[model samples]
Target: MKRFPAAAALLAAVLLLAGCSASGSSNDAGSSVSNPGTGAVTGDGTTKDSGVVGAPQAGDAAGSVTSGSAAGSTSEVATGQRDVIMTGSMSITAKDPIKATQDAVTITEQAGGRIDSRTENPATENQQASATLTLRIPSGALDRTVTDLKKLGTVNFVSLNASDITQQTQDLDARITALKTSVDRLLTLMQQATTTTDLIAIEGTLSQRQADLESLQSQRNFLSDQVDFSTITLSLYSTGTVAPGAPGDFWTAIGAGWAALVGALGAALVGIGYALPWIALVGVLALIVILIVRMSRRKGKAA
Candidate 1:
């Protein structure tokens, strides 16, 4: 009976040990699954836990960060860019220079622009004048302004020009954006700066960035103003009166002859009038001499 009991206890102990071993094996597998650093799950039910920081969060969704940043940079560049140069010219014949200039000024104002300068002078005719005006017409209204200028008088000449500055404008805009980004980074560094030298250096960089930003802003503003307006040069010409002698070849010759004859007769009359005083003096002297000669001869004969 004692032997039987001892054998039964031994068998139970073996089974318990086996159960504990199996439980321990299951626990170890679960621990390995929980700690991905120690294990991995492959695509085919195989788990592999890499210790390389989860592939760095997939590097910003496979270029999402870079693409977004590039898109933002492009948008800023577009807004900060420069504009193209536009120019136009017009010439017309006007009867009155002042009125033409006045009309040009009105047109420029209506077109959202201004007159830069103006000049006027008398033409070949007695009352005719010519005028020239330099005006800045809004880019959108340049064509309309030119058309209005033409309507002021008889059209003589017209021209227009457009110049592209896409490359230069894009380059400037990129530089400005890059500088702004650098300034932002520098500011962040300044916030974390502990040493005095580092702080001072960051301050200097910030100041430089501010100045550069202001300069870029000024340049952009000027460029915008220029691009938004088109320059137009308005010139007025006058038609002179017809010269009398230039017309009617045969009649002109006849009239010229008549004028010459009249001129000769007037000259002869002026000459006779000028000699009258001298002629009178000569006659009085001759009469006195004759009387003296006759009296002297009679005295001599009586003697």
Candidate 2:
């Protein structure tokens, strides 16, 4: 009876040990399979957190975020850079200075621009007349404006220049905004400016800043105008021509030449006639001086 009880107890202990061993082996095998030869173990026996060597670091969530932001910043800078300033000029020859200038003005207006100034001279001899015009046109229309201007006359000179002024424009804008803020602040503090000395100092500083603001505004307007318009110079000249006479032309030419000579002589005499008073005054002064000296000499001889 004692041997039987001891044998039964041994059998129960062996079964319990076998069951525990089987459960432990099953859990370890599952972990190894999930890791797929990487020797990694996770609480859930899942391979989501484990990766092969050099596997792109699981798609880089934080790095991707930074890269996106940097790309957006670079794109903004490039776009701002594109807002630059460009200049263009053209020279044309026309048959009439006034007509050419008028035509140019019309064209400038049609191109959504205005003429800053126009200079035309018709009284100048040699039939060489010219007009210079400063115009403001949109940058997009610069090329078309030049083409249209060229149609007005023979193109003598054409030039174009482009410069990056984005930085300058931005800086000026910022400065203007700051000056405006300062002006507003000063106005608010006007009641506090009691003492004469303080008042003078404040006024002086305000005046300076106001002047600067005006200057900056003027510059901005000028730049804006330039960006919108192109400058053009037009010159006009007439070709001189002579008419031929019939067979007895030599005699006729001689007679005409003689008449011209007589007329020129008459003009010269008339011009000299207008100068007679000044000429007489100079002569009288000289004679009086000479007579005074001679009379002094005569008086000395008599003594």
Q: Assess every candidate by TM-score.
A: 0.52, 0.54
**Which residue pairs come into collision in candidate 2?**
136-228, 136-229, 137-228, 137-229
Best by lDDT, which number?
A: 1
> Which model scores highest in TM-score?
2
Candidate 1 lDDT over 1-303, as tens digits, reads 655554443333333323433343243324221122211111100110111113223333223323443444456557974357898788898767678788889888988899888998755423456788889988888877788888888898898898876544544444444445445544555565555555565576457556766786788677777788888888887656453334357787688778889999999999999999999999999999999999999999999
lDDT of 2: 0.54
Candidate 1: worst-modelled 10 consecutive residues by lDDT: 40-49
Tens digits of per-residue lDDT, candidate 2, 129-150, equal 5667777767778778778888
The per-model lDDT (C-alpha) reads 0.60, 0.54
> Residue 234's C-alpha lDDT in candidate 2?
38
TM-score, candidate 2, is 0.54
Each candidate's root-mean-square deviation in Å?
30.6, 27.9
